[model samples]
Target: MRQLRRLVLMAVCSTLVVASPTRSLAREGVTQQVHEARQEGSVWTAFAFNRHLSPFSLNVDVEGSVATLTGTVENEVKRELAEQVALGIDGIETVDNRIRVDPGVRPRLVSVAAVDERLDDATVEARVKSKLLWNTRTEGLDIGVESREGLVTLSGESASAQARELAGKLAASTEGVERVDNAIRVTGEPGTVARAQSEVAQAGNLLGDAWITGRVKTRFLSSDNLGALDISVRTDEGVVHLAGTVATAAEKELAVETARNVRGVLDVQAASLKVAG
Candidate 1:
């Protein structure tokens, strides 16, 4: 009887030991499946938001850190674009692009909701407004900006004809703006300069030196005339310092004007900026 009882207890212990690891492994497998699903969802959402890849109904599959893309695009360029976008996502170490390049494959008509379209337009409008507010030439002017499908419309009042034209130029130069319809009326307002000064005074207290410097550098980077030029910008207490090499004297002058136009710039010291040989 004693031997039989000991044998039964040993069998039960052996069964429990084997079952524990099996249960643990089952849990681990589930966790891995969930992680891969989330990664796949992330890649799918990214493709949906991307302008170039959104039109195509691309399928994404993720395994561990690799994402596999399969779809049909109009050309090879778009197929490559899709791969690049997938690789851009975090945790996606590699992209296996199996997209077919069929010239006959037209982009599917992906119907974007009206709300999404409006959101895009709102983003463009905000960008234009920010550009105007940051620019010294257009800041403090009563300008209204609206955007729809990359078309920008400008209205309100300007103090001078030059201001009105500058507003238009700034809007046209913006990234999403396809065309600008400038309807700003020149009111010959006397307080334009004063209002500008007052706005700057208020901004001076809030705008840090680093913020001013960054804006100045960004302006240089975006300017077609200055983007290629090597320019260095620094700011201290609303005063900006510019240093770099420019090909021509006119370029140097334009650089100075650009720096001066940034809001919160109390003065510009450009003596260090020199013309190239």
Candidate 2:
């Protein structure tokens, strides 16, 4: 009886040992399938975006169940359509679309050196300003314009949100603008006290953003180290968004510091500023 009991215990132990490994192996297989499914979803998303948005440069990166779409597309429709295609993929859990719209430029194959060889910044700025001035909606507004590497930045104060949006559209639709960062603030709401916070006042200080923008632009023009025309500066309620390219790293640093030192500038953001190689 003792031998029989020992034999039964041993048999049970062996069964458990064998079944445990089998279960672990099955789980690993499932995990691998999930990973492969995510990869497949990313590839399919890319194909769909490319098929639909052939004229735009779009890239997809997938991790686990999340898909991130990056690169530049032409216009808003293409940008939205790329996001939709990524979301439609079966295994994707989320889609982070960071694709920007290049209204004046189309997708092309070129080297970084070639990018630096494109249209001059001064010409691009003039074209953008002309377009904005011709547009009846944005005409007569003191919109501070700056261009760098075909990207235009419009800084000033608009009468309303609609006018601000219209100014951005005009800049983007210009002949030389590859992208536009419309930092024009809408007046009549509140005065920009801090970078993000604004306090309500008695129907006064409506042109606060415009004042800051003009001051910053004047400082840039006066500075010997910074090329005001090569850099685009936009002041949105005292927060300065600098876009465009500079000659060197030193110039970039000077530009940011200059913007920060401005009397009314609350903060300086240079994420859009790219240095020429």
Candidate 3:
């Protein structure tokens, strides 16, 4: 009976360990703790005190200690100061610095701040929309550009998924883009999502690409290092190339299918792709 009882206890322990969702719980707990530790009021006080920053020109929006700082500053230096102050506080979890700079500091910003510093609101919107329509990837054009203030808001439908995401990122990163409101949706083609999803992901991924191989492991399917892997993307010339060694033939087809969905892709070249694994 003693030995039997020990076996039963061991089985119960194993079951409990398996059933409990500890991995997910631990991640959530850590995120929550970070939020709790970073309180808003404390960050605000820090923002107010920093010599390089001033609360008078800053706006703070806080939720459960997470802070988003948005407003206008005179120049790039002041804009950075605002972020530094908010994050310097020990308990603050996050800081979003969305501040606009004066045109005097940078001519491009003078043409892009959301508030009209130069032209009428209607005129600004028209000009921005016209630009989007001209771009191949920005087919579904919904643009709101306040020329007087030079703040641009873009929304609409694109023929391809890659277009929608690239248009937004391009606008956001533009020299004249003071504030980019990306409302573009991915629709219009069969394989649209696949092509655009990867590129959109790459926009952020390329910044710190070394981190990806550690996280999203490559599952190769073929003998050739390049084959068996799936890669489909629209080139600058508007051609789609499907390359990679896959572990199986099914993966090769799936990769091709993924490329076919992108809007404005001339054609998917799958001859270069192979499957092995």
Residues 9-34 of candidate 1: C-alpha lDDT, one tens digit per residue: 45643654587886345434433543
Model 2 lDDT-worst window of ten: 195-204
What overall lDDT, based on C-alpha atoms, would model 1 receive against the true structure? 0.68
Using TM-score as the measure, name the better of candidate 1 and candidate 3.
Answer: 1
Which residue pairs collide in model 1, if any?
A: 136-261
Clashes of each: 1, 0, 34
Residue range 129-236, candidate 3, lDDT tens digits: 333433334423333333225466765566666676666665555434566676666666622221222222222211121111111111122223433344533233
List ranges where model 2 is wrong by over 4 Å.
1-206
> lDDT value for candidate 2?
0.59
Least accurate 10 contiguous residues by lDDT in model 1: 193-202
Candidate number with greatest TM-score: 1
Candidate 2 vs 3: which has more lDDT: 2
